[model samples]
Target: MRIATTILVMLATTLPAAAAGQAADHRVLPFTPSGQGDPQAVVCRAPQKLENAEGYGPEICLRNGIWILLTQDAKDLAADGRSVFKRPLVEEPHGNGPAEAVTCRKPPTITASRTWRGPVVCLENRVWASLYERGLTVTGDGRLVSTRMSGPATDPTGMPVIQTTPPPRDAPVIGGYYSPL
Candidate 1:
């Protein structure tokens, strides 16, 4: 009876530790995208740790339909040890008409520049714009000085520039014949 009681106690303590260890080694399941599926219908893996760099996280589904995983480098602890960070691809619609209307519920990501600093605003159409601060007084030589506008700036072009979304790294290539493993 004592032996059985000791076994139960050991299991009670060890099981929780084992379960925690398993949780720490979290990995995302594989995904196969359908040809004619909606872009919003896609899902990716969840991040394991909270200490992720900007624009890159584990199991994050990028706008290009790829799942990105940033794993720690077991080797090379000093130089190039961290994973690469990539911004999501965005495609803007083209028109001679007025600039596409955009609204932000939260502050957008700020991208710093030597000439001009601005915010990268993601629009409702999933398009992103790198807009310059409006009403900034510039020198005769074109250096930015001060701004009369407040909050985030607006696109100087009156039309926001859009970028094209790229495909996932592991996505199948067209016209290339290869055998599936």
Candidate 2:
């Protein structure tokens, strides 16, 4: 009983600070996109009117709930709902070449397995990356394999960007593949 009372007292003191922090975040990032359909990816671009950054990613476009999410990376559509939180994700594609990839200098989700967040390409600095993982080899008779994963992607700006999502060591890559095993 005593411990419970002490805990309540602590909450009474910190509750105000927590509320203030959330209010500040809301004020700083007021615009959020509306979307619904299996949270995939999101981007927070320099907002201008209602239109946000197009091309190159899940840029913020419209308003949704408390938090904003990106639904369609191409059309810049806003998500309809908010995840428990946003996920910082990386896009590496292997649909183009055996080792072609583009490395997004941002934080990404740490999925249980490999995640293909974007198309395969070679960036200016030549950072090999892919949205797909495994290799061109598949269980089927010489066919590219792909899978649709469903999960909530956390926000990076609100959260701290941690260790690089991509491999620490640069190496050759290939794409158009998935693994159920």
Candidate 3:
């Protein structure tokens, strides 16, 4: 009986350590809704592939180092390079309410390689914007600054969109590259 109890205690201690190690490697990206508009922008981890998925739309990685799923209509607007910060706020056509605007600062420097530091913006019920291929640099004040890309923006359809199954709940936001704004 003493041996069994010792083993149980050992298991309990090791289990937590093991879990913490795994957690350390995994990133938690929480869904942060920005606007007051209806059908709030849904941000979550995207599946590895978007092929033939019903209701699911295009995805983009935010400056916060998290992936988010956008509504179809919102996807369309983002594809056009429109940002809530650049455009005037307006009411949703469906009369849900005034659209909420999201703004992100441009990265301070541009790089030739893929990076998580880029501009990201979204409006409630309207659009989701991102600067693909751009790198991000966090300022001393914790603001996300954008960097320039070595090349011109690629075709939106050609951007690297990884596929992964959506988690049941929003993951906790993690990673060193967080949005300063």
Candidate 4:
């Protein structure tokens, strides 16, 4: 009886550890979405508008280093190549330069944003109205990033989007892939 009890206790602890170890082995599988990875596939707003640009006429919010390629269509984020950008991008100074290229990778994913950093220039096409106004923004357009907060602030949505980590270990990270945001 004493030996059986000890075995049961050991099984409870070692069993979980063994299972977790097996899970780690299969964790490296690349996460693939259901389509030809396209940035325009994501159709939604960042919720927090960091900067605004007036292209053509209407106002466009540059969120998470991405500019609102189409004010009417949030999913369609285009680089301001044809002088489409109207705001003072943090990347270009003086606001007058050729439309730079943005090395677009995978598809546009969605994640639970951690914090807001105002406005910033993460892409080249999102360069200043031209190529003269390049810099970073201090606002967050409701993008996703994993960060550790120190103080007690609040999400504009009155919800907890940013947190310690993502949903689960196997959850597909949103808003791009590695490196958080």
Candidate 5:
């Protein structure tokens, strides 16, 4: 009973001290109403209207360093939503040879995987990309090879067409015979 009492006493004493130490050690970052980071610092300027925001929006007051970061983030977010064709050409084509050589009826998906996301358009180079997609074609074994190809395509509810002999990788592309695979 004495040993149990001693352990309980020790725990009771240590718990409050540990909690106090934790509270004191906490490093709280100062967020002042004034544009300046320091709480004691005087307000340098009034809050400015957010220019990038459409229609009327709330004004925000932040330090110069914070403002620059927010502006850059806004610009990047805007560019991300736009199609690759609309933007300047920076990324190289997925396949060999010039991207210009590959004729496209509609804009290519322009992503990591051609059959991953976005609209799948017929390209001279990657004709198989349009094929093997969900609505267009399934494998001979009745497996979904690609599910991401979407747009004006073949009947999704139509009967499955099986290919007995699949063509080689170097076979002539289907959509347009611009060049040999």
Candidate 6:
């Protein structure tokens, strides 16, 4: 009986250890969404669910840094009670270079609107309007100035779209892939 008891105790202790060893052997191998194996690789994670959605929405691959920015933006949007249509106001310096140097142009519909009270620069074929001209407006004079406290960036769901870590440069695109600029 004493031998049997000692055997039972030893079995209880070693059984789990043996089982764990076996489990570790079958551990999930690290692989990118592209099916490439890299132990040190940062694979894109799942995007955040908005407004208590049941599902995770979709599996999109984005850089971890971008994900961080998006997450912060989402949190800020939530706190500001602003609509997703509104974008956060970021301060930008007045360009001393030619107006044509700016690649993008503000849409005419936005510029023609009555609410558009900001400085509107009319390019040859494009109209450039400063969207960040919310709240208190001040001339930079080549210096940074504080702008309005606009809401944070948000997705259509009025929440920040959380993204996962970025994959290797050579990883093939799978599902919804976002390329960082």
Q: lDDT per prediction?
A: 0.30, 0.30, 0.32, 0.31, 0.30, 0.32
**Reference-based TM-score, model 4:** 0.14
Residue 32 shift from truth in candidate 3, angstroms: 14
Residue lDDT tens for model 3, 1-181: 4454444334333433444434434332222234233332222222223235544332322222111222211222222112211233232122133333343333333455743443333334332223222344445333556654332333354443332444336675332222335
**Using Cα atoms with residue i matched to residue i, what is each candidate's TM-score against the true structure?**
0.16, 0.18, 0.16, 0.14, 0.14, 0.17
lDDT of 1: 0.30
Q: Which candidate wins on TM-score?
A: 2
Q: After superposition, how far is residue 149 of candidate 4 from its true place, in Å?
A: 20
Stretches of model 5 off by over 4 angstroms after superposition: 1-55, 74-181
Report the number of clashing residue pairs per model. 1, 32, 20, 27, 0, 1
* Tens-digit lDDT track of model 5 for 35-137: 1234322211122233566443212222334322222222111111111121122122233333212322222343443443223222322333345232343
- Cα lDDT of model 6 by residue, 38-90, tens digit: 43333342333446446433223322232233332321111111212112233
Per-residue lDDT tens digits for candidate 2, residues 124-163, read: 1122223343323221222345454323333433343233
Q: Every model's Cα RMSD, please?
A: 24.7, 20.9, 25.9, 28.6, 22.6, 28.3
Q: Ten consecutive residues with minimal summed lDDT in candidate 4?
A: 27-36
> Model 6 off-target regions past 4 Å?
1-45, 63-181
lDDT of 4: 0.31
lDDT of 3 at 98: 34
Candidate 5 at residue 113, lDDT?
A: 39
Q: Which window of 10 residues has the lowest lDDT sum in candidate 3? A: 64-73
Error of 2 at 160 (Å): 46
